[model samples]
Target: MTTLICTLQDHRDDVNWCAFSGNLLATCSGDKTLRVYSTSDFSELAFSPLSGHGYSVHCCCFSACGQFLASCSTDATVVIWSMVSGEIEAVLEHPGRSPVRICALSPDSVHLVSGASDGTLALWDFPSKQLCRTGTVNEATLVACSFSPCSQVFVTGSTYGDLRLWDLEMRQLHAEKNAHDLGVTCCTFAPSILSGGQVVQFRLASCGQDSQLKIWAINKFNFGGYKMHLLHTLTGQSAPVLSCAYSSDGQLLVSGSVDKTVTVYDANNALLLYTLNQHERYVTACCFSPTAPIIATGSMDKTVNIWRLEDGCRGRDGKSVPEQSALTSSEGRKKIYLPIHLCIS
Candidate 1:
């Protein structure tokens, strides 16, 4: 079971995206700035708004190592900030006026990729902080991009509903397809690890305006080159799906939609688990924390909500959250899914 933990309220305008590194949280906003906070609700590790973007910051993500934060904005710029120093380490501007919809960092945090509404994609060498390559999709906008957990391949989703996979090392398109009937809003890759620390098939989840979420499986063990196969189409969202994320263990999948609800599903079984309908407005963005038992969501209502897992709700393996009773139940003498809200720091 999941319960709302904190209402991260600070953005003057709509919150566009939220991400977490360890217990630290980061949010991008339409107010043209980004803010970071501590999950523990303690002032010992909190800070005020960090404003430098010339336009709305569309998305932000912490690097794999959590040592750096990368954000993209409508100002055609991507800023890389050092987590240790709280200072701008580098600024990368896209070639044109088109807003960079989102950006992703390689698993090793050695490279960065940004996508724009004009269907342009640019790859940057983080060591030198320079743009090294570029590509374009057939659609009107590239809505999302994500690097595989293996750090070898990357995927891009387009506004016009196109999906493409690319080889990072070879700098070539690995696979391309028209993924959805409508615009693809978000995409996320499953973690590389499986049971017993064994590496197996690769999987991806993507949400779109079609009001459907699709899970794609990539079988690298194939004798031929790896190919994408649609594994499941998870439905129930009545409105356009805006954002989605797979839990760190790849057992649970969560998605936010224009329907003003957040849905969670059993990733392996594709069973609908829970729907969090707490947001009054469209839920724009969401992500799972790397080192915490919580997930954070951002919305057009200018607030971020952190949903935390109960102590006994998750499986001992830490991969799955067991199905709970529809009404209510007790887990180890504690009321499971006890609704609560907190404003900290």
Candidate 2:
């Protein structure tokens, strides 16, 4: 069973992305602000609604230790903020001053990558905040990027429907052309790595405008050869899929779509488990809590819904069970029951 525990209607414009650290939940919006909340009570932090971006903030991510946050915007800069005091630490501008579409930090928080609308990618040494290397994909707008579990390699997806693998020096290691028709919206690597004998394998999930969510297997051989293979293609949504993410255990996968729905799947078997329809507008972003069986979804309706998943999974009739719900706003917390239906698949 899934329960809607909290609803946050704080953003004045469309919410673009939502990310969760160990204890904090950060959400960015087209309102040119980022808001941070406490996972324990879903309360807004004192220094939240961080208004540091000159334009719409496209994406935001927290460092591994949750001490810092990085946000990229159409202002053509990636701003780093201190999580402790909510102060600006550094602002790294894009090379061509093009709008930044995405940004990601390595799992180890040693490296940070920012992708621009002009096809330029800038890699930075996180500790010192120094630009390390710059690369570009010809005539493509970079939208999605993620680093492997080993943190030695990263993958990028572009609006040209291609997925390119890169090494630490920003060299192209391999490329998969036409991976998604239309355009790729988001991609992420599983947090776990598999090693058996001489082969190391990694799993990746990507969603696109073609209304498809794909799972892939990337293998690294002992001889240093790298290969990518398509594993599963999921078509649970009727509209373009916008965002996807893997659970901390790598056992569950979740995705949001323009169909105004969120789908949860069993990652191992590629079976659709639950279909959640709560958002009134396009579901733009979805994220799983790192320490709990909770999900935070942001939408074009300018609201973030926080859902809690109970133990076990099974098909059930779509019905509403009364539960205590709290909504946080600038005024105060309001008590109400926001009935959220979950359709078993």
Candidate 3:
């Protein structure tokens, strides 16, 4: 069963994004600040509500080892902060001075990519904090980006309803046009990689303004050719899907939507497992813990809800059967709900 552990109501404005590192939870907001909390107790860190960005902080991501965090802002820059000291480590200015909508760190922490409102993407050398290259996607406003498990390539989704793959050299390897009907909001790569013979495969989950969540299979062949194929389209949420994430084990997927609900799914089979309806406003962001059975979801209501999966609550192939889940709201009231299934298109 999934249980609502606690709710963090610290952000003053809409929570734009939420992320979980090994032991910490980081949340960004339209209030122009970022907050850090301890995953163990969901308490705000002493130096939290980090005030460095001049404008709304759109997205934040942790380094592979969780030593540092990078946040992008409408101020046209990405700020890197030291997780231990909670101080600014570096500030990366976008090449064209356009508002940065999203940023992501490579799995190996060797590279960083930041996307701008003007469709420009800057690839940076993480260690040196130097800009290596820059590229653009026509006139599309880039919104979503994620790195593959192997860290050699990354995927980017945009307001143009396309998902593009790029290598470390800032070269566009492949593009999936019209992947979503409307704009893409968020995309994430599964943590694990599948390898067989000369082919390597990776799974990706992306949600969009089309009110659909999609699973994609990205494959790399021996001849250095790449291909992308649609695996499944989930139409569980009635409203536009905003954010989606894959569990650390790649066994489960979670998404938050404009319908004020959060949905959890069996990632392997694209089966809906749970639909959490506690947010009073649009659910804007969702993330899975890298080291625990925990989820952090942010909403337009300016709160971040933390959920925990019971020790034995596994889906699909697991032996335990999920009957119901309980939610403990911030007001100390409890609510329970039965799981609802959704169709896979």
Candidate 4:
């Protein structure tokens, strides 16, 4: 069951995105500010509203180790902050002064990459802050970029709906495709664990303005190579889907939409597990906590909502929750829905 724990309203403008690092939640906003909060009490941290950007802060991401944070802005610069001190450690200047719409750190935390509005991707040597390489996948702007779990590959989603996977070590294309009808807004990867712990598959999830969500099996066991295969498509959203993420255990998937609703899915079977409608405006961003069952969402309504599922994979006493047939109700499109295990407490 999912319950709204609290609503955080620290930003003066629209919160662009929210990310979790350990037990702390960091949020960036159009007001050109960044804030950190404790996931436990939803209280503002001492080093909140960390201001350095001269323009709208588009996104913020934490390094895999949670020791550093990287944030990009319309000011054409990416700022790397030391999590140890909550202070800016370095500033990376983007070429051509293009808006650095998104930035992500490689999983190994050795390289920092930034995606610009002009459709270019640049890699920086994290230690020295030197531009190592810059390249373009295509002509359209890259809207989202993230590194794989192994850090050997990275994926990019374009404003033209282009999805491309590149081998970071080899600097070669692994796969490419037109993933959706509209611009792809987000792309996330999670491990697909086989039953009885046989094999682990890499899966990719993507969403966009098309009001659809897709899961793709990225690495094939049959072919013994990396190739994307359509796994399933989840629909029921009436508006464009904006963002998505997988739980730390990869047992659940969550998405936020322009329809002002957040939905959680059973990742194993692609079942609609919960539809949360608590935000008053467009849900611009959503993410799962690093080590918990909590989901955090940021909205244009200038608030952040945290929803948690207790005993995520098991029932109250450690046994698995018994499954029943899907429920049918007359609420139609106007009502929010949740599974039997869902709760408001």
- Could you say which candidate leads in lDDT? 3
Which stretches of candidate 2 lie above 4 Å from their native place?
Answer: 312-345
Q: What is candidate 3's lDDT per residue for 1-345, written digit by digit as tens?
A: 666756788788999999988889999999999999876667689998799999999999999999999999999999999999999999999999999999999999999999999999999999999999999999899999999999999999999999999999899999999999888999999999999999999999999999999999999999999999999999989999999999999988999999998988898988887788878999999998887788889999888888777642374332222334444443532222223110000
Q: Please write out the lDDT profile of model 4 over residues 1-345, one tens digit for every residue.
A: 556655676688998889998767889999999888766566677877789999999889887778778899999999988777789999999987889888877767878778899988888888788898887866788778877777667788888987888765436456456687878988888743342233345788899889988888766344335567789898857899988888888878889999998888877788777777777799989998877777888999877777767657432321221223122223422212344233222
Off by over 4 Å in 4: 169-172, 191-200, 220-225, 314-345
Against the reference, the lDDT scores of all candidates come to 0.78, 0.88, 0.89, 0.77
The residue pairs in collision within model 1 are: 117-141
Poorest stretch of ten by lDDT in candidate 4: 317-326
Residues 223-340 of candidate 1: C-alpha lDDT, one tens digit per residue: 4366678999988689999999988888888899999888877788887777776677999999887766677888998877777765412433323333342222223222123233
Give the lowest summed-lDDT range of ten residues in model 3: 336-345
lDDT of 2: 0.88
Q: Cα RMSD for candidate 1?
A: 6.2
Give the Å error, residue 14, model 4. 1.1
Candidate order, lDDT descending? 3, 2, 1, 4
Candidate 3 global CA lDDT score: 0.89
Clashes of each: 1, 0, 0, 2
